[model samples]
Target: MLLAPKLLRSSPSPSALIAMGALVMIELTSACNVVRIGERKISRKLQRKGLDANTALLGEANVHYWDSGDSPETAGAVPVVLVHGFGASAMWQWHEQVGPLAAERRVIVPDLLWFGESWSRKRDFSIDHQVETLVALLDHLGLQRAHFVGISYGGIVVHELAAMHPDRVAKLAIMDSPGRVYTEADHAALLARFEVEDFADVLVPTEPEDIETLMALGYHKPPRAPRWVHRQVLEGMYGEFRDEKAALLARLLEQLDELDERPGKVTQETLLIWGEHDPVFPVEIGERLAAELPEGTRLRVVEGASHAPNLEHGALVAKWLVEFL
Candidate 1:
């Protein structure tokens, strides 16, 4: 049974604003104990595909992850770390890359704090915290350095890590991310385009319509699924980590004003993969992002794809990742 979370922010409508004041009260009483059957099955199937489920205590958070075991062959193979975005766990986000990449390399995929089984009550939800936590996780695994692959929000974290800890990153791959601090105008325009009051409403969807809106914006050719599937996913995959994600985004936005719009100088080798028809970030942003990075940063545009290109064209994305990393 898929039970949906009742806590949802409103669209940019008068009716939505009317109930905004009561959001806190409603969230206090709202419980997110839903277990999505479909996601559960996928998780198990991924485990069988050699992505072993594991957990590690990093600071106050207990991070759940999928690990392709480190072995004699893997010792020489490059370690590739996959970080997920806002909506789902690492398993759902990088399902395609894990199995294929693991065949030749060591892959580590982790659920960021406040997503999946990772949770913490600490109010410090900056992107740097995630970077530090991930660094610590890498340290715990005895990994000195690895190539980093991130998408959307995860890409932002990878960017920060590459900028702050250049020595620790061998290669960086960022997909469909803003890549630089977004200007206030950029933020306002995206909100207007999405027809939503805030990002939390869209990223952590509560209703099937919200999921539909996310899909419509995320893909140039959105996958067709039954209404029940969206509902189950909304209830199961998106129910947990409501307030925490909002706080995390809020903190991330707070840093935006502090950073100049121009991309900071990053020393590591970089690969930027984007969707040609990305409605969320747009292809123009990718062009500008490429110019902002260090010399020789390569940009690859996936034709006929959108924000979530990895999902829309998994085979193409996997090929790019394999070649880049």
Candidate 2:
């Protein structure tokens, strides 16, 4: 069974307004990067939780990850690898769940190639390449199998990984990812909903307004913040590797048909977590995917949630993941 958290207020509180004002003041008066400052704070928290930042060079790609290094408390537990979506790095995306999930079992969170410190010189940005890189990262860590949780685009990657190398994946959790079930009509409708000709404009945000659009689409109750703060996020987080990221999005869409053509269903027992009002990939897609998967597959919809429930309801999502994995 899936548990739901209390719905967060859609409107901003007075305290939130005051904090936003202070952030604007900081942006105007100081040279400190607001996004980086926030990232550093999150990094310190994760460090305190026993996750160490490290890098693994996998031939063509350099993968940067946070590992809850081997310890007696989690010695015999199967490691859980958290794969983040298109927007920010893994740390920024999975910060909330990391501490809780890491407390019981080893958790490995890696920055996907072209995001954070992980990157590849090879021009290939297909999902298959991403799966290969993640497999290489696992091999580098000497982990033969692990439970995988992937959100958004990362979901597509992990789905491909499980399908291509079923032996490498013990259990799978897909959060708001469309996978091969996304059809051409779904792609067209997504563009029409966002009023953009290219989906990359929606995913690979380049402007402050783009970020606003993303938050609006991703969350049921998007947090209120000033435009300058959004600009800071755009510059600090989404600015790097803009072109490559756009290319990656394009390649993903282009390769969908190819992926669908491949044979066989994912044999591993799967869990699907979706936001009730996900505008990007609607909950209907999740229902369709669940029916197509193995007999034991299940879909758990979070009430009053949007595209990224893990961000909006992190604790609940983590609880479900811990129980399922």
Candidate 3:
């Protein structure tokens, strides 16, 4: 596969700008919904594998969660919460990051309000609101501090979480995410690209067909993804079954409307992670986001992978996360 790589342009000790090393990894030949993960761990690993991991509640919709290490008792064991991207659930993003992090510290994965089993007709999916909900989740679990790992839209959630409730967050890992002010072309591209497959159109119901076509153009290897996952998510996008999406999209659009051509509040120890081959937001955006943070923030670009590096190149993503998270 053709590869592109980026490095952190900073000195660890403020004296010398170290030349960060570059690495090349394999591009898998097949599209896997999940490469085997969460198998063994010191954190509490349950049998809720795949969609089977779903948890539901009556009045307060149950949010499915996976945890490895619990900080409730241990001193050094702080939790790491991973969030997914737009139109995807937590399972879709952290299928790889979850299991490995669970090996040592507590790794918590929750399907946000709109996506997965956490679907609610009342929950707000606005970026800020979602971050608030995340913080509340931590509070509910009696966790006061945790490392946050969010991808794409999820990355933005952590940005808000760190900014709004800085006391609850310990560190941040943002991967291939869009910034506070997404440009016209960039925003349109995010909303318009849907041509990866017929079902991709169905997945983003508002414009599933467009999204499917966009995927074909955006993904380094769209064909590498299975037709079924695309189909189910696509159909769910606009299908009669996704009323939750309608409510979520409404709030999300409200968030876009509230934007004022600038990033407002921000405070957190941040690490920006990106895929060198990412066709979604690309490396430039990642570089910009890292630059916008504190002087010492880090950026790592995984070579030979695209938007969903956690899926395409999980091990590499996991390796960096093991150290960063």
Candidate 4:
């Protein structure tokens, strides 16, 4: 079963939605009471407002984005585009690369469809549709393509984008991505994990000071997630229509069940990056992606990082990407 918080009708509020999600469970027990108290305590400690960011409506979705320091024509600078993973918005990950990468290149970070303020007009979140949305976004911005960097589930989109718009993609980078072979077992595990007692500690986040605690259960030590980042991540992601999100994910899994993981139609240049400690997809998966991708794929790993090498350890990740691309 997928976990969706009922409180999010349209979107999640800033602080209240964060704490309440931790306490939203099926079981009514004394343990839940304790969890509620803990949530409240954390909530009081970190009462945050919404994130200060810009939004551009793409189709039926609100594409939340942050522009890097320089622009394409900022006197001859290559543009870099960043895409986030599942259950996360642009603000959640890319901590290390988005800002610093902007120093030399123009960076464009947008909330992917189904995860952030962005939505799918078809109410679908398939790889094909996601790739289409990205291509449309790029066309909207009047760009052919830039350096593409994505993490975890975002890697799936990177793969699709490269396959769909090889002409648009200049260089591709994926970190600990669930790019190929999205198994049903994986979905089952995610569903089971979401219902656990300390699920919020990982998914919803219980510790205001330690936002990384949210990914404690993950393989790699989740990157250092900031409070404001969490505020935007939680609100833009997991509020309202809880049941709908769950159903949608389930439907997506069902749809992926029939699709080809190794679509074998890729032509984009790619750099595959992974963290050895990644808890979710693990490091082994990265090697598998290298084998499946079209030729000229570069594979590298970050030592201390977890699922998101770029966010957990952005500086070095940026160095590798800046050099690789």
lDDT of 4 by residue, 1-325 (tens): 1334455664767775655656554343433343344444433322221113566667765566665434344436657888876554565566456545666766777777656566655766466666777777777777777778887657777777777677888878887776655576765665564555332334444334334445563435444655655554444345533444554455555665665644455667778888877666666767877887768788888887766666667689878887876
Alpha-carbon local distance difference test for all models? 0.80, 0.89, 0.63, 0.63
Write down the TM-score of every candidate.
0.85, 0.90, 0.70, 0.68
How many residue pairs in model 3 have overlapping backbones? 19
* Model 1 pairs whose backbones collide: none
Please tell me which model should have the higher TM-score, number 2 or number 3. Answer: 2
lDDT of 1 by residue, 1-325 (tens): 1112332432345665446546644554343323345467768767776778889988776878888877676669779999988776777778877767777788899999999888755667998789888998889889889999999899988988888888788999999887674577888888888787887777767788788888887788777877766776777777787778888888878876765543444688899999998777887777888888879999999999878888888888998888887
Candidate 1, residue 186: the lDDT equals 80
**Model 2 alpha-carbon drift over 4 Å, by segment:** 1-32
Top-scoring candidate (TM-score): 2
Instruction: State the lDDT of candidate 3 residue by residue for 1-325, as single tens digits.
Output: 2322322333233222232212222233122213222222312233332122535442344566655544344448777888887654565557666666766677678877767556544455567666666776787677898998888778877877786777888888888885564455565565555333332233355443444554654356665445554554455433443665555555655575455453455567788878788766778878877777867888888877688777778888888988876
Candidate 4: residue 62 Cα off by (Å): 2.6
> What lDDT score is found at residue 248 in candidate 1?
87
RMSD of each: 10.1, 10.7, 17.7, 11.3
lDDT of 2 by residue, 59-114 (tens): 98989999997889988988999999998799988888888888888999999999
Q: Count the backbone clashes (under 3 Å) in each candidate.
A: 0, 0, 19, 9
- Model 1 clash count equals 0
